[model samples]
Target: MAEGGTTLEFTPTWVVAVVCSVIVIISLAVERLLHFAGKYLKKKDQKPLFEALQKIKEELMLLGFISLLLTVFQERINKICISENWLRNFMPCKKPSDDKDEGTTAHFQTFFSPPVLPATVGRRLLSEDSSAPTYCSIKGKVPLLSTTALHHLHIFIFVLAVVHVTFCALTILFGSIKIRQWKHWEDSAAQKNYNAEDVLQKKFTHVRDHDFIRNRFHGFGKSVAVLGWGHSFFKQFFGSVTKSDYITLRLGFVMTHCRGNPKFNFHKYMMRALEADFKKVVGISWYLWLFVVIFLLLNVAGWHTYFWIAFIPFTLLLAVGTKLEHIITQLAQEVAEKHVAVEGDLVVQPSDEHFWFNRPKLILFLIHIILFQNSFELAFFFWILVQYGFDSCIMGQVRYIIPRLVIGAFVQFLCSYSTLPLYAIVTQMGSSFKKAIFDQHIQEGLVGWARQAKKNKGLRKAANGNSAGSPPGAAAVQMTKVREEDALLRSQAKGTEIVTDQRSNSSS
Candidate 1:
């Protein structure tokens, strides 16, 4: 060992490589085992099992990838730490230059300053111990991590991976349970021989009685009150007034007016419209928020070594985007419900085509602009991540990367609110949407409306051909009539079955 440097045992490169490889192999083996276990455990409801196993595999794969990167860049990372004078006390055989030492101190001071101050204060204070060896006092080559440290690191990572997998499995399991309950409820209602109107009335009663948002916030407020800052007031406020109450009040007129409308099943429509949204938006948001929490914990624990701090903007954008999307969707659904109530039916009106065609040009222009911005931002963020590794993002002379990222995310948010609207409008114009809407209308006793729309579509096509100097022949008109009769007959048969089922239940 050099002068002033203490002799230290270093983990060999081969040993590090072998350890990393073993970790990766073990992770892969665990993933495979989980796959088989999931298959054996839930052969019928394989979706939830598959989802849990997929998440576990992703977490383990990330761990394995990180371990591989650490092993591959071991020497490079050590050199960087030495040059930056990081972990100097831990690597006493490596000495940083005097100027670099001063720079390092300044760097830490800046790093520990406000915004990050609370998080790093303990580390800074620990570094200031007088008995700690000076940076320049160390001189020889020193491993940034010893064998024991490496083992501890691996164990920590493994534990975290296990915890993450467990959470993922639990979340999926709960979601699956909810799905199963919904299915069971639907089956039970069918077996009870409840007609559509009866089912709708029951659902409407439940919706009217339940204050979902209020109850949720009430519990949350109680949890906050336990923190003891007079948050009982918060709990009381949530208990008194819920957000769902506002929605109920706003739609009260529509609900009352449409209750007696046999042409429209407003309650059934509301339940169907919101059920999928609740599952998709709320479920996805729950998972994302949990991921964000886990990521923040890892950052605070220094597990990512400051590299993943750059991902904060993107992660936050994703979480906020999902939440905003959910809110906007709910608002749109409410507006649509009011419109349907005022119109007194769920029929696709002839005026709808004119309304869409005459939509403000500015709105269309804005849609394109928003879509472009979203696509560009997503593409740019991904490109940066792929092109510039974590070191480059955090420390490797990349100027203004973080600021640019922040700007991009801010711009994305400014335009992201239009995403759902644009998708809705575009899909509304699609054939699939038309088919689904018409089918739904038919089911809701609006078969005449669908028949008229189909007839109008055929007429428009025939008129187009006639305008091109190809007049429709008698045979073509007859064929169109035949097609219409066939569709109407099929719809009537479906309606007959529903009536027969209801009559049989009444008789029994």
Candidate 2:
């Protein structure tokens, strides 16, 4: 460890452990604070706490992966520099002297010795010449790095970061636009009195039948024909969005919620929505399947650099997380179903709702732990990036680095926390839309049924009046017909009551 302008020394293992423990404690405290604040600010109809926590959890998950990648990237760069002896240029060395002494040998040994610090810290120490070296004579110390190398590396990393940010921005933009389009289509269908289930089933069918490869080639040809062979050729080529691009988008809507009514039988809906697509994927030709596999491999290789080693385990973790979410959803659905059956009602009880909202304690804790670990690592990596350039060194700044890492993590949490209100607003708007559509549909159905029942009753009364003048057998037949009609009306009334109960439950 080192203070301002002091000699660099190996940071004690205990110090590292203590710092990590403190970070974890601080993170947990912040989470609890956010949770309490959300609870305090919650309204009668809102779920501010759940919404805030969910957003934070998602942000942490993303940051964790990003942090791991950046950390690994920095490490790889450090290894390259070390292997090429490029770091030696930054090391403090003694001036060439004619005196042959033990002090000189010791200085040389210390200067050339393998760095005990982690690659990130070692690189930071070397790059940041905040103070004069106190460990060895600095008479022959070289510049940290050549001006050309420094500028090039800095520019390269800056560009890479910019590109990454730009890509993410574009993806979000396109996704939002697609979602808006889907909402518009849904609204149009609702206005025209289309059945929500039918619309969703039709979308699933289209997606299932879509040929991923064929659409790409067809869209490419169409784009080329429209744009012509000119300077815009490549632009048109890449910018040509196909039907296949929309497949996943459509599937997302279908799997997540039904149009008009969001609270449907989600587990069963997912199975039905995915069944055809799953079969289609599994039934693809062998050569095409091989192509798909190769394409996926190539994509993974191209996107992930040396961090693929980390990516493998992260990917596995993601799979596990996804499976856990699925299991939880299924279990909740089963519980809800059982409750409905046992109670002989469509309304879900408050207890069942609580169970749905609050998942198993152990599962939740494990997830939180994973998220916290990732978030801490990400913050530490971010601090390193800020203090030292991507390819720079850290020789004597362990104490400073730890504090900066903690500050960085805190800042990130605050930033995420600030977005809670916006997320809540957006979610509220979506809920309002679903509720509005559901209410309208229900109202129309009830009105139509009421009119039909009134008309049937009037007709039955007219038949009874006419039967009073007919033969005994005819009069008996008319009475029996009225009884059947009454039974049918009773069943319809019961069905309508169930719908009303469901609407009330949903509103609550």
Candidate 1 clashing pairs, residues 3+ apart or interchain: none
Q: For model 2, how does the per-residue alpha-carbon lDDT over 384-470 read when each residue is reduced to its tens digit?
A: 356443332221135544554454343333212211111111121111112222343455666776787787788778777888688
**TM-score (C-alpha, index-matched) for candidate 1:** 0.33
Candidate 2: what lDDT?
A: 0.36
* Candidate 2: regions farther than 4 A off: 1-33, 40-178, 194-383, 390-497, 500-508
Q: Best candidate, TM-score-wise? A: 1
Q: Give the local distance difference test score of model 1.
A: 0.37
Top candidate, metric lDDT: 1
Tens-digit lDDT track for model 1 on 1-508? 2221222244467877898999999968976898787787456543433444555556667777868876676445434323333443322111224334322222222211111123223332211322344433254334344322343344445554454344323333343333233333333323454333543454323221244322322222445534322332233212222234323322332233332322232222323332222222212224443643454334321133233444443444333333323332333333343342332212121112222244423233333333333333334344324423233222223444555556555534332332332222222221122222122333445556467757766865665556545555854665577567767767876775566345433422
Evaluated at residue 489, the lDDT of candidate 2 is 69
- In candidate 1, stretches whose alpha carbon ends up further than 4 angstroms from where it belongs are 1-32, 81-159, 174-188, 191-508
Give the range of the ten consecutive residues with the poorest summed lDDT in model 2. 343-352
- lDDT for 343 in candidate 1 is 24
